[model samples]
Target: MADERLIAALDVSTRAEAEKLVTQLGERVGYYKVGMELFYALGGDIVTWLKGERKKVFLDLKLHDIPNTVGNGICSLLRLRPDILNVHTAGGLRMMKAAAEALHSAAAEADIPCPKLIGVTVLTSMDAEDWAGLGHTEPVADSVLRRAKLAQEAGLDGVVASPAETAEIRRACGEDFLIVTPGIRPAGVSHDDQRRVMTPAGAIRSGASQIVVGRAIYAAEDPRAAAEAVLKEMEAV
Candidate 1:
């Protein structure tokens, strides 16, 4: 199951590319992340198609709003019944709690299992200076830890953080709290737009329950080989 934590991000714009990646890496990856771009273009059909192929989907909408609005949004998303979902921890404890409760309630009423609710601590695009510019004097690691704790307290299943902060988050949030690291770059891969990055082995060693890899795999000359390499690295750790 630990090996299955490598989520290959299908960052393609079209369904053809998405389906091709799924076909190539689906056996190696347990879950495929459907982020905003693909979700916006294809809607729930993407999740449905993935399920048809026996793949668990993580819908990374990162929903954020007032407590009532976010709760309503989660209630709606619950109908799609993804394996996992996420909201921004910056949404505050009340919003997070409300969203969780509403999702659980909706799932119960619909006779469906509730999706594991995760929280997004900070975007992988930002760094320490970015946080400082946002009026946060604390280091990026400190800020991530703080948000992760808040998410756990509000009953979230885990948090999405950079791989660099996985160890600190694990130490602060406990072993059971899932840490999904997104800034994973395989060896020799370009960092792209992500600021905080780590290799697959490094991410797993840092205590990541799952690692979200986008460009590193999708943009590779041989995506299947790239994914397999990442799996081997993770196994080595």
Candidate 2:
């Protein structure tokens, strides 16, 4: 199995909270995800700070826009040179392809390794009913599969999906297509805003290449211990 201990989302509102979590679990986690919350507060400097501390970063802005606009946005983010980045697959093939091409061009220009670009299929917070309301006639799993395939066809590195759909996505997209799941709730942790969640071991067993956990680690009384427990669970799987 690939190292499943990937980006641990620091879903805080300030640099201090993010940095504290980084200090606690930085060594255990492979990458730290600076999502909209923290990124909005601290900007690209957060990524620069994490890099300065020798930690890989995943800038999860989930950029979505027209092809040209999204491409420009991706180029802006590529300048930061994060280890990973993502865009909503719903943006269509042209947007995704443009983003991918821009990322490669930016990396080549900067003489840096291109960041792995993943696609967000569906927010884990949404369910079958939510999709149905949005006019999706198929089941949630089917929709997720469709989006994953679209992302793969668009030349994305992989997708960010719920753990429940990871296995199916793996089978459909092939073994090497990265699966980064976020709706992970350890055995006793609260689910919070995530609706489709699984345990770390279960996610790994389902063939998820990487897991992005937030509250299960960040909200724990001992964040480092929580992160270590997750690593142990991943290793066990």
Candidate 3:
């Protein structure tokens, strides 16, 4: 059974380029992830435009800051009415809880649905070497699991992790928790800077609730065709 869990990463640098991809892919994908590059260029206007086109938006700012600052930032993002938002789990429990509570109060006051708040456990670009450099003695998976448990306790909806860690997160947090995996490269695709990656089918089967694909689709000769092909691969599982 297939789910509409594919989040198209709008990795372009400008709003026009991003919108062009959105128009090209159209409804072939249901969700779009507005990451730092595009967000920095166009700010909330890009999010507003995507919502106007009736697309679900995942605002992947990966916010990491002091609790008060993070809470205020969440307020500003909530007004955009994105379908999903996330913070860095490395920001710790206080920051994550503050984000969640800010989402709650903002949504209630504005009378809108609260976007699913997720924590980014660790970037897929890193591995055990990176963790060691951060002065941690544990393996990458252990660090991810520990941060995931903290996020859950902090009241986050779920976590953003590599496909390799999704099963562990699911085991620790249960089925209801969302696991959004990035670093997905379809078969025969270049891995780019991603050190840890999986095929879309592999990630989904590994207990990921959602998968994010950027270069695999956006950089293709025909983005729409690439997106459709990815959807097909996701459905095959």
Candidate 4:
């Protein structure tokens, strides 16, 4: 059951550390997120190693740039063959569309599976205050839904959004669109730097397609047991 929808964030900085965590979690976690910290250090080596171990990867580079640059970057990452990839939806419709097109075209040419191209609607670390500072007068929830719709229109598979907005995105984007939520802290755990978070069961109940968890598991004294607890919470829904 842990293998189904839980993604353990391999937040370590070295390939060896990531591999050690994977070995520790073993079959409990099949999906891993290699975000900027680790990806910057190892590049595609981490992804390739995960694939070699037959584990799924979410390459969370959060690409945001000019249309051409974002699209070209997606094309390059496709070679690593991550199961999922994401871009910043704030880059606007054109950039999202370019990433989708580039991902599909390159994967087709290479005869490999194209990673699901997800757009990031809003970050979990930001609450209303941070959002307001960015000059968004509209409600954060409203902005998240609007971005989700834009990502849909741009041909993105789905979005990386907070669990607080998962139900709305699910309602607006339909059941088929992927919604990967990252602000997941197990019950009784500290929220850490993430401001918009939900318990494991609550996220699944809110219609999250998948959940990414980091410190709640990795920082625990026993990571495998922590992962099992999260999985149990997920199945509680």
For all predicted structures, in order, the TM-scores are 0.96, 0.96, 0.97, 0.98
* Candidate 2 residue lDDT tens string, 1-237: 224365688899998888888888756776888899999998999999888887788889999999889888988988787888999999999899999888888889988889999999999999888889999898999888999999988889999999999999999999999999999998988888788999999998998988998888888999889888888888887
Q: Native-vs-model 2 lDDT?
A: 0.88
- Name model 3 segments beyond 4 Å from true: 1-3
Stretches > 4 Å off in candidate 1: none
lDDT of 1 by residue, 101-197 (tens): 9888899999988899999999999988888899988888888889999999999999999988999999988999988899998888888889999
- Better model by lDDT, 2 or 4? 4
lDDT for model 1: 0.89
lDDT digits (tens) for residues 83-133 of candidate 4? 999999999999999999988999999999888999998999999999999
Worst-scoring 10-residue span by lDDT in model 3: 1-10
For model 2, state the Cα shift of residue 179 in Å.
0.7
lDDT tens digits, residues 1-237, model 3?
223699999999987798789889876777999999999998899999988988889999999999999999999989899999999999999999999998899899998988999999989999888779989998999999999999999999999999999988999999999999999999999999998899999999999999999998899999988888888888899
Native-to-model Cα distance after best TM-score fit, residue 54 in candidate 3, in Å: 0.2
lDDT (C-alpha) at residue 213 in model 2? 87
Displacement of the residue 163 alpha carbon in candidate 1, Å: 1.1
Candidate 2 is scored at a TM of 0.96
Question: How much does candidate 3 score in TM-score?
Answer: 0.97
Model 4 stretches with alpha carbons more than 4 Å out: none
What lDDT would candidate 3 get against the real structure? 0.92
